[model samples]
Target: MLETGQVISAENGQAQVHFKRTSACERCGACGMLANGQDMIVTLENTIEARPGDQVVVQMQTQGMLQASAIAYVIPLLLLIAGAVLGKLALAPLFAGVESDVVAAISGIALCALGFLGIHLLEPRLRRQKRFQLQMVSVHRAAQGREEEQIDKE
Candidate 1:
């Protein structure tokens, strides 16, 4: 996805850009939707020589985005289903006296929680990888002017 953001700060080959959340951002939910209407600020490598106050278009890798979405959404769901099946089949047989349904519920919940914890633990390592990073495509001078004009009109 491509987004327009204003450079908030720049130094030593890096820049911090602030993006206001829009309706499109709601669909992605990359930044948590807390209902606070706050801006999403990200620090990116400054290959384009964008300065503070400059408006630029940022691009995130499409493949990486899809991979991330799968990792965040699909994997946990698959894990939950696997957990439920395991509880019903494997774990139920081991806990002889207990009700099979109850054992299944408990085991499934435990495994689902473990899946979430695993994702949390893996996040930091994912962030350090360059393949998943967002990039600044170009400074959008014309778009910036249009934005300022709209603000003035409002």
Candidate 2:
């Protein structure tokens, strides 16, 4: 995804860019509530040497976004189904007195919880990978005019 933001701070080779949540952000659900409001800030590697108050374009890989969306949404659903099936077919048999449906519900919830834990554990490693990183595409020095336009519209 591509976005425009203002560099709120800069240090070393990185900058924290503040972006107003766009229509695309509402649909993506990537940042959750952080993207629900107007103030969304992200720290990114400032390869273009953008200073504080600079308007910048940010670029993120579509492929990585899709992969992350799948990891966040799909895997847990599959695991929940798998757990429920296993509980109904395998576990219910072992517990002779228990109802199969009840066992399935319990197991499904347990596995879904485990899936969330797995994602939590995997997040740090995913963040460290370059393919998942957000990059600053360009710095715009003529941001004052655009900023004024934005304020007038608001």
Which predicted model would earn the best lDDT?
Answer: 2
lDDT of 2 by residue, 53-141 (tens): 87888887999888887888899999999999999998999988899999999999899999999999999898887778788777776
Error of 1 at 71 (Å): 0.7
Clash totals for all candidate models: 0, 0
**Tens-digit lDDT string for candidate 1 (53-100):** 878788888898888788788888888888888999999999999998
Write down the lDDT of every candidate, Cα atoms only: 0.78, 0.81
Model 1 residue 54 lDDT score: 79
RMSD of 2: 5.5
TM-score for all models, in order of appearance: 0.80, 0.84
